[model samples]
Target chain A: MKGSGGARRAPRSTPRPRGRPPGRSSRDGVIAGRDALLAAAERAIARDGPRVTLDAIAAEAGVTKPILYRGVGDRDALVFALAERLTRRMTDQVAEQVARTEDPEDMLRRLVRGYLELAAAQRNLYLFVTAGGVGDKRLQQSLLLADGAAQQFVDGIAAFRSARGADPAVATVWSYGLVGSLHYVTLWWLREPSLELETVTEHITSLLWTGLRLEEPVD
Target chain B: MKGSGGARRAPRSTPRPRGRPPGRSSRDGVIAGRDALLAAAERAIARDGPRVTLDAIAAEAGVTKPILYRGVGDRDALVFALAERLTRRMTDQVAEQVARTEDPEDMLRRLVRGYLELAAAQRNLYLFVTAGGVGDKRLQQSLLLADGAAQQFVDGIAAFRSARGADPAVATVWSYGLVGSLHYVTLWWLREPSLELETVTEHITSLLWTGLRLEEPVD
Candidate 1:
């Protein structure tokens, strides 16, 4: 139902025609096969938590271990691939929501709220991906997401301060700082739902605004 | 040699005094014993990385599993205890440094630099404490640190903005935001140490200053 590609395909119970196979191209076959495996993996993860084994995942996908291995390199590789897909979806959503506001404050507020909402919507998936692992792939994926978000902010901040001749190089640092804050804040806020989302957003926006606004040096 | 309390004491080689041990209270004995055990655990963690086991820790501490268990609850408890100690040391140092600066901007800048310096000084220990674990104790320790840091910032910011009648309630959120940013920045900065510390500090401080200083409200 979540557009898991192959999950909605005709059930395995459908009998294959004798002698002649349907004209599903090899490329389409590979893509559908991978999608089906991923969908099965997702179900397995949801049912068995993030630590589910490859054997279980393969069984859920209605395939053998070899097929699962062929489709996705390995467990770590599959998790990393899923992370890419999830992070992309979350960032794309945040980007779209952030673009809705012209005012920088509103833009940041929306960004924060959008991020929180996404976390709430996909709390389990978030936990599965963020469940600390032995590999550095997760951190690498995280940094990739942070870097992408920071670049967007850098571009926006640089343009906003262009007339004042502000050194745009600082944007890289500031954007990282902002993304880092957002990342940890999301984790913290997710655990404490009693903390009002709007209030947190306002505070974050205020912090960003105060920091970004031009002012005399405070020595 | 590290101060590991009773663990560092002469190995049961000296003859016991005939009379009751002169003025060595039971409470003092317990305290010293714990310190010694903790010291041993620290050495083990330093040598074996964060994933070092309780058995290894006990061996390093010169005690058996029972003694280590009695001295520290378990592995998780031991880690939690160590986190408490480390977090306390780090925050106490930060507090002392922050107190030296009366200017708010200078105070915040000092706070940021102090935290990074602590991370750099004890990178291994930092990893030991922050090594991703199962239970939420790590998060709890993190929250404890953030709450402490936030309280300090809230008090300072409230006092600084008292004349402007700024609502101090927002300080809680701002403080957490600042702490989260610092936490993530430290992690990022650690991995990419090629970047100068002063530059990162300057960028972070600038962002904080721009956000904290009064300016026209963004509509």
Candidate 2:
């Protein structure tokens, strides 16, 4: 909610402009370089699961540890950046779908389905981001990323409800609750994808849909 | 579902039984000793959060690192044991409440209230157990604990719906989803605790109650 979620996304990895300063570290160059490194890191996570080390990430990027460090700071910083990137990508995908749909149930389906597909597609990376740990710093990082995603849902829900003259006062609580549900459900489902995607999505959609339409005051 | 969740509970830490042997380790002695160590570990977690060190745990138990190591295999093993203990305690609390309540809504309210209060009482300990980290091993431990809790809810839902003559086919999905919601909501609420307990519990109850009573099939 503090910053536009859209701004966090790096522009696509564009080719560096010709005649760039040979010995200068331009900001644009630095941003592009970091994006490329993150891309490499994503590939490594997809291949090696969440336990992929910084050394492996550097190797995957065809760079040394120092360069990797320079690109994304230390491991925690790298984790933060990766979390931001992934959350933003997910937000963008869901936003794109929301923009095209005015029906609340359809929007809910799109949001839930988008989340499931995104998590399933990046199973290892998602697991890497959410794997259990034991520390205050890790707790903060995990919450920070989750808050970002939840805020996006909050915004979407607010808009959805307001459009139909319904109070959106429960946006924050419901958004967090829904995100938590999606997260653990996706974690369980990824282990065994026996349940069809449509069925799971519909079940979730029905829950949220009915709950939202309740005549009882949410506030 | 595979095991009686009740069997997971270790008996109360009792004084060493009247000695049958003067110079050997007795099975009751071993059980009581480990339970004592686990109690000490719980105190440390309450005091120092999830990142409490083995040395600190050992000290809390009035023992040395080697003794702590001998009792619990390692840090991860200790974590696994603690998770089991906490999850089983939570399940028992909810199950007890469920047994007394004939009304499904009342049962759910009790379940949510019980979970929230228990989590609030062991704030640091709960956070320590749920903290995010690296490795598939950690993931497995976390999931194993969550699955246990989810299974308890599944059983509760199946019983509740069956008593009312409703098909309990969606109980598994609903159970996992509901557990995940409660887990994240509890995490968020513990940080703030601004909302009234009844309000939060009522909100969650309404969501689940309305959803579960849906006339449409989950499929």
Candidate number of the best DockQ: 2
**TM-score of each model's chain B:** 0.75, 0.74
* Per-residue lDDT of A195 in model 2: 84
DockQ-derived CAPRI band for the predicted complex in model 2? incorrect
Candidate 2, lDDT over the whole model: 0.71
Candidate 1 local lDDT, B67-103, one digit each (tens): 7888878666786778777778988898899999777
Question: Each model's C-alpha lDDT?
Answer: 0.68, 0.71
For model 2, chain A alone compared with the true chain A gives a TM-score of 0.74
Error of 1 at B21 (Å): 24
Top of the candidates by lDDT? 2
| Predictions: Cα RMSD each | 11.5, 12.2
Over A55-111, each residue of candidate 1 has an lDDT whose tens digit, in order, gives: 988889876787788988776678766666677787799889888888777777787
Evaluate candidate 1 and give its CAPRI docking class based on DockQ. incorrect
| lDDT by residue (tens digit), candidate 2, A86-178 | 888988887788668876568778888999999888888787776622465565565544587666655555554454443333555555677
Q: Give the fraction of true interface contacts kept by model 2.
A: 0.40
Among all windows of 10 consecutive residues in model 2 chain A, the one with the lowest summed lDDT is A210-219
